[model samples]
Target: MALKTFVKISNISNLSDARYCAGMMVDVLGFNIDPNSSTHVAEDDFKEITEWVAGVKFAGEFHDSSIEQIKEAIKKYPVDYIEIADLDLVEKVGLLGKPLIFRLSITNEEDLSKIKSTLSYLDELTKLVLFHCDNENLFDQIDAQIGFYNGNLKLMKGYGITADVSLGNFPGLALEATEEDRPGFKDYGQIMDVLELIEED
Candidate 1:
């Protein structure tokens, strides 16, 4: 099966989540590579899970790791893309030559300027910006600016994405992989529901 639009399943830790997302033809499967993250995927585990999947790009998600730390991790865990939350790290991280996905956190109106400024810093190496919000109200506020982003950068909504979301000008939606019930078993849950809702023949 194939989704009607671009989809990225993030924080994938196990083979179950990896294989399932790949089978569903998602565009990207992201793993938490930040060692400090509670759900961090070690090199060994990352390899084992990734080995069983195909046809999907892998992303190394970093939250607070420094440039040196990220460089070291890249050598150990090779991923097609790098996902980061800090805007300041963009230029430095881009120098490493890996495509970047900026995870922008929007909480209030004050952040509008920050988002606008982020657009200017995004270079060709920047793949896309994943906008994550704390609440639906904030999502609505930020969603208004989606039209203002008409550059080469792809923008995705990481909040308030339901089966019926208008999708409008955005290229795709970002979803998270659910924890498996057991090593090889999974409930699929909401990710499956949304994927099915948008499934194309």
Candidate 2:
């Protein structure tokens, strides 16, 4: 019933701040590797940050990039998990024994169908982050999808989750908090509160 918290640190300088805030509770720490993104931290920066924040699980966030690049990053940086937005890249790379979490752009049944088609291939997928891109009523469809996975897959809801709403939800779900989502609070007290609630439940 423990809720795992993942914080995305865009700036490598803020790595210490993130580690300090996260303390000993955070389950995963994410670093953005996309060059065009504002959160983009270089591979060396990722290495330095990971060394500083030892013990806490690490993840690298990637967008539309080549499989070779992704594989290189995984080999060089080597985080516990890799967060990818592209399913094709995931299939091509084959996850390489490392756990993967797909940040999917879910909208309608078609998108879900595509995800379903790839599920059998995503053997390393530990979780799926259902991204709400077009203000769609995704919450309504989640229950059915959860049933479809039948407790085998972990579900993470992204793209509009606030600390308050995140805390309201309980156990067995993953929550990803980006820098843009909550800029001020480095410490994830709100997320920890949610985890505590899940444990209690």
TM-score for all models, in order of appearance: 0.94, 0.67
Error of 2 at 120 (Å): 4.4
Q: Please give, for residues 1-201, the per-residue lDDT of candidate 1 as tens digits.
A: 788888889999888888878998999999999976877888999999999999999999999999998999989997999999987788899999888999988877788767767776774558688888867777665767787778788887788877677677788789888777887888888788888887898
Q: Which residue pairs collide, candidate 2?
A: none
Candidate 2's residue-wise lDDT over 17-125, tens digit each?
4565356345566667754476677777677657766556776777766777777767777777777877667656544767776666777777766655555555445
Clashes of each: 0, 0
Superposed model 1: Cα runs more than 4 Å off: 123-125
- What lDDT score is found at residue 102 in candidate 1? 92
Worst 10 residues of 1 by lDDT: 116-125
Candidate 2: misplaced stretches above 4 Å?
Answer: 1-13, 36-38, 113-115, 118-136, 159-201
RMSD of each: 1.4, 4.7
Candidate 2: worst-modelled 10 consecutive residues by lDDT:
2-11
Q: CA lDDT of 8 in candidate 1?
A: 88
Residue 2 miss distance in model 1 (angstroms): 2.7
